[model samples]
Target chain A: MRLELQGVSHRYGDERAVEEVSLGVEAGELVGLLGPSGCGKTTLVQAIAGHVRPTAGRVLLRGEDVTDDPPETRSVGVVFQRSTLFPHMTVRENVAYGLTRQGTDRITACLDLVALDEQRAAYPAELSGGQRRRAELARALAPRPDILLLDEPLSALDRTLRDRLRDEIARIQRETGVTTLFVTHDQTDAMALADRLVILEAGRIAGVDRPRELYHSPPTRFVASFLGRSNSLTATVVGVDPPAVALGDTRVTTPELSGTEDLEPGATVTCHVRPEHIVLSNTGGATPADTGFPDSLRNAEEKLLTLAGEVTRVTDVGHHYDVTVQSETGTALLVETATAPPPPGASVTLGVARDSLTVFD
Target chain B: MNWTRDSRSGYSLERLLPVLLGGLVLVYFAVPFLAFFTRTGVDGVVSGLSTPEARRAIRNSLLTAPVSTAVATLLGVPLGYLLARSSFRGKRLVEAVVVLPLVVPPLVGGTMILTAVGRFTPVGSAAYSVGVPLTDSLVGVVLAQTFVAAPFVIVTARAGFGAVDERLEQASRSLGHGPLATFWHVSLPLAGRAILAGVVLTFARAIGEFGATRIVAYTPQTAPTRIGVEYRRAGIDAVVPLALALLVVTLVVLMTVLRLGQTPGVDPP
Candidate 1:
């Protein structure tokens, strides 16, 4: 079923927890609410679940308004961060609890769905963390809800288990074809599982787009920084084309912006360049003449920006070495190098790629 | 090394003082009860049990305590669940009022009941008009016992209801059960242990209730009031056998309750 939230706003006494938020989820779509702690993501999910009523808004389920409906009346299921399984009931009994209320037969269907059929007789306390989470999910899904709200379903597991359950949860959602809204602070999980990402900041939507689009072309600085690491540099605009910006004898281009109508000459602009795009080389190498400039001329015309500093540290982080390059500009730039990293106290030249720099006016 | 030994000695001595004092207090309390039991052998116990007044008192105590406990559970369980789960205006005030009897002395509670349901009051007059006397009757004893014991059930049941996770109830609700059905299937089952504990505690409190029953309904003598009356009329020897009998019965009930509390899977009701 389709779920739509229109002009949703909620206030807790004096604090405006959520404001004027609107979004929609089509059937079988798994959307994610990505935000840090206290960013009102939980409030938004709770509002949809009818646990918390919005001060001003309407929740539409399949074109029917259910804003004033109580939680029991609304056909929504919510799985909390902590697996709130009934401690008194066994796993099968817990799953059957919701079914019995619906006048459905108490079968092993739900237990088999979550792959907990073997442990159906186990109590919640006897089950492992992952088992309990699956049990909770099965319990929530037993009634065939129109919407499923998952509040950080994997936040309680360890790193390895979280990765395993993350895929399991996504698979379950896809197989069940439930309109699911998952909330989490972990960006990796959001990217891997959600069909669309809705990043919330300070109770407001920072950005909402497909996972890849939101990562590759963030609409706001907050979204860019929150999604992943990016090197931000301030530059002055000398000229602008459809996809390139000239900044003080340095021309940089990015695919993020297709046109530059918003830019003005000499206006200060911020540029974000991914670290992997920057190429570093030994400074004494001969430069190709025909491709760019003559070797002697290139050597004579020193690289406009060169930071000469001793490397304070080099950390081998699996695929890349994080080189701590301290420049005379008094700023420490963390440059990732796939090659042999310079040892501590060795001097190196830092080169930033022209095409990799993303200009934001 | 010397300082460590001295410190250890000091700590041991400090621990010993409380243990000694506690042991002494235990003996002080137990000596009278032990003496009573010793003086009243099996014959005296049997003789006490055979007495018409003693048998009547035992029957009254047994009959009224559970009846009052059941009454308390019937009224207190739902009230406790409501107080624990729902939030409305004046909820805190209502909670405080429900637990008010816990703070009042049993005799004072009985006095309040007497004032409210005396022969001259409207309720007393209505009962009298209906040929159903309350004062000095078994109903009065049960009412007085319930007044003193219902709060125990309410308090314990409230705690039990509070211990049940709200998410469980929410899950049940989402599964198509209404609020009341959810309570029956999810909330109440989870809180069963607490409810059972409350029943035991209320029953124990009712059986031991003396002051209230003595004030409101002295004719139908429960064990405590009967022991008191026997002591006042015939001195300590006459009351000793009856006191021992009451103590034994109470101890057996309390032990049974403790055993029930120890059983696993008896969650809050």
Candidate 2:
């Protein structure tokens, strides 16, 4: 492990900010700490940076116990949420600040790595917002620290600039191969940049996994809802052999049903599925025949839970439309599709693959 | 100063009130300086400066003020920084003590200093034994000026250090610079302009310090003390030129300090 936080807990007087968060980041791997604001994400970053000593627990850097070390003694480079570039210093000077030897060579290389060599002579105030972030990145990287901690590096920026800088940071992290711990509230940034994601809620680790796995098979409901758009429907178990659950009058069963080992028949549970995983087929307006089931729904040979519903709302969200389908039993399910959505009040069928439903009690 | 009215009426009291209220105080300050300048021309200033008494006073003021300012900068700046950045058991008490000199009447402050270091006191006797008398000497003048002026540096430097972002210090530390280095490289530079402003104000205060200096040291006359003595003996005509010389010197130094404060390289754009 390049960095390990062993049961790190921090308290600000009476209020507990972080409570026993233990995790490890592998060498050369970029691990993201994903959480909502005030979930102790920044506190954890501060702990690793040695700005805050945890009320309890140890911080290990390359297997060395650095719990009592001050920030200057620890070889940790940090980029705060806001630009911390020294206002009085030019980009080159700021980058050369931490080096004791070969200052100019390291400064030039780091500035070039961030593509900020052209603005090396400019003061922090002279650069644009993106350029300031880039300059800060160069300054942090110039020291060549063992571990890099980025605390919401791409926040408070416009969408285009944020995405561009996000990609730039990912590229630099890869190029340097520095063990990095990225902290962000934005799931998109975390999912796009991290090798593994540690999801925090209320200062506790809710789940830790690869981004895709965590999003699809979240260990907790907080992870499921917070990671992406999810539709949660209450269902009851009808059988255990094939792991069947009933959505009102409709029975759906699949061998891939999870969280069903301790569940008995007639047990109430909440099933969650991502909006994009549910396929919607329009059954109204100029159908060749009204057989009460669309051909697209009938032909699905996969274990599917089919629900007959009417389109209650449709929102065009740039690349995709979110069609909200209200079933006959009044269960609302959101389906995301790139195809043209049926108008509101039109009849539709929601086809949900059985494996996509993540049930929780 | 009349211009075309846009949103305002020509006779509106709202627009005129500020000028009227501010102009009253402005006239109060301007009338004295104006009368003195109109009464004494350049010839008078030259003749006054040529006098041995005026030259000695000028030399004395020039020598003591800078030393006092330096003393204030050296001692008060660290105290100011400590007040700004740290918290201790008696922080509030320390702040109050720092401000005590500023609020106390100069004569009372001089009397307070005498109580601690009078000739009969142990501190004064020790200094006297060492061939450095604490009162009735140039050292006394410096002590009086520093006692009166040091608070300005302490107050302004505190405010300057307060305005500096703590995150910048933290950033420097994380960049592999220790706390002392961070203070030298980041906090000191960031707060430089404010501390400089405080130093300038301290010098101005020190040069003009009279009441305390008069009580502490009467032998070596500063410009203000000499002006007071000369005025009593020879009336307004004799002192006008002296006062004008002092005014011109103070104004020149003030202007130079202000100019230095705004230097392009030192100050952030």
Candidate 3:
């Protein structure tokens, strides 16, 4: 582990901001701390950066305890949510600030790394928001710190600019190969950028796993719901042979229930699956193209638990359509599809793979 | 959309109330200056300013005010920064003490200063036993000016330092600078304009100081003291040139500081 937090907890007077967060980031791997607002993500990052000392526990940087070290000696680079670029200094000067030599070559190289060499002479206030963020990244990276921490780096940007900068950050991080710990509330950014994601809720670690693993099989209810647009359905166990449950009037067998061998018949459980994983098909359409799921998942139709419902709403969300279905039992299930959705009031079939289902008590 | 036309022609009661109220105060402030400039002819001003007493007073004011301002700045800036950034027991009490000179009447403050360091006191006699006298010399004028004006620097610089974003200091610290280095590089530079504004205000206040300077130093007359003496000896007309000179000096300093403060950068919050 390049950076490790050992049972780190912090309190602000009476309020616990971070509660016993223990995690590690591998060398050269990008790990994201994903959470909602005020979930202690920033506080955790601050602790690693030596900005705030944890009330209890230790922070180890490259096997050395840095819990008591000040931020100046920690060798941790941080790009804050707000651009902390010195408004008095030009981009060049800001980048060169942490360098021991104050060499122009090194400053130019860092500026070039962020593609901000052209704006080197401009002050922070003079640059556009994206440019300012890039300059701050360059400045933080210039010192060549042991680890990098990004706290909501792209949260303040507009959707278009955010996508552009997100890609830029990804490219920069890849090129630098610096061990990084990114903190953000945006699921898209975390999923796209991180090698692993740590879900935080109420100042505690909810779950930690690879993005796809966490999305597909979240260990906790909060992680399943917070990671993506998840449709959670209450189901009662009807059989234990293949582990089956009833959703409304429909019966479905989910493989995830196999983990709990002790579950008896009539026991109630929550089944979670992402909206995208729930395939939608317009039953009234003759062509199979109207089937929203890919051919691979469709061919394995027998492996799916199907539900019959009426389309309550169909929202066109650019690249895809978000279709809301109301099952016979009145349970609302959101389905994401690339194909055209059935109009509201049209009959539709929703199919979810048993393996993709995450069941929790 | 037609803001200009509305403001020019509408004159609604709501707008009229503020305009009337604000205009009264504006007129009251301007009238005295208007009368002063118009009543005292340019010849009277030039002749009065050229007099030996007036020249000495002008020289003396120029000498004492800047030194007093420098002394105030040197002593008050660190105290201001401390008051703004640090937490300690009696902080509120210290803040109150910083504002004491500002709230106290200058004559009463001068009397208070006398009790502490008057010629009869230990400090006063000690200084007198040496070559310098604390009460009757130019040092007394400086002491009086600093006592009255130091509060301005302390209060304004405190506000200035307080307005600096702590995050910027944190950023500086993260970039390998320690606390003191962060203060010097980030906090001080960001608070520069406000501190400069305070220094200018102190200078202006120090030069124009009258009541305390009168009580402390009577011989080495500052511009305001000279004006008072001229007014008593001759008339208001005799003092007009000296007053005009002081006004011009103050205006020039104010204008320069305003221009310096307008530089495009991170202003103190």
Give the number of the best model, judged by DockQ. Answer: 3
Assess every candidate by TM-score: 0.87, 0.91, 0.89
User: What DockQ was computed for model 3?
Assistant: 0.58
Q: List, residue by residue over A1-361, the lDDT tens digit for candidate 2.
A: 8999999999998989899999999999999999999999999999999989899999999999999999998999999999888888888888999787856778899999999899888888889999988888888888889999999988878999999999999899989999999999999999999999999998899999999999988988889999998998888888888778888666777554555588889998888899999877786422213423446545443456777789989999999999989986687888899989889999887777777888877
Per-chain TM-score of candidate 3, chain B:
0.91
Looking at candidate 3, what is the lDDT of residue A349? 75
Order the candidates by lDDT, highest first.
Answer: 3, 2, 1
Error of 2 at B112 (Å): 1.3
Q: Which ten residues in a row have the lowest lDDT in candidate 1 chain B?
A: B260-269
Q: lDDT of model 3 at residue A337? A: 86
lDDT for residue A47 in candidate 1, whole number 0-100: 87
RMSD value for candidate 3: 3.9
Query: Worst ten-residue run, lDDT, model 1 chain A?
Result: A284-293
User: Which sections of candidate 3 miss by over 4 Å?
Assistant: A238-242, A258-265, A281-306, B1-26, B87-89, B130-132, B256-269
Q: Which candidate is the best by TM-score?
A: 2
RMSD of each: 4.3, 3.4, 3.9
Which parts of model 1 have CA positions greater than 4 angstroms off? A101-106, A237-269, A281-310, A327-330, A359-361, B1-29, B251-269
CAPRI-style docking class of model 2 based on DockQ: medium
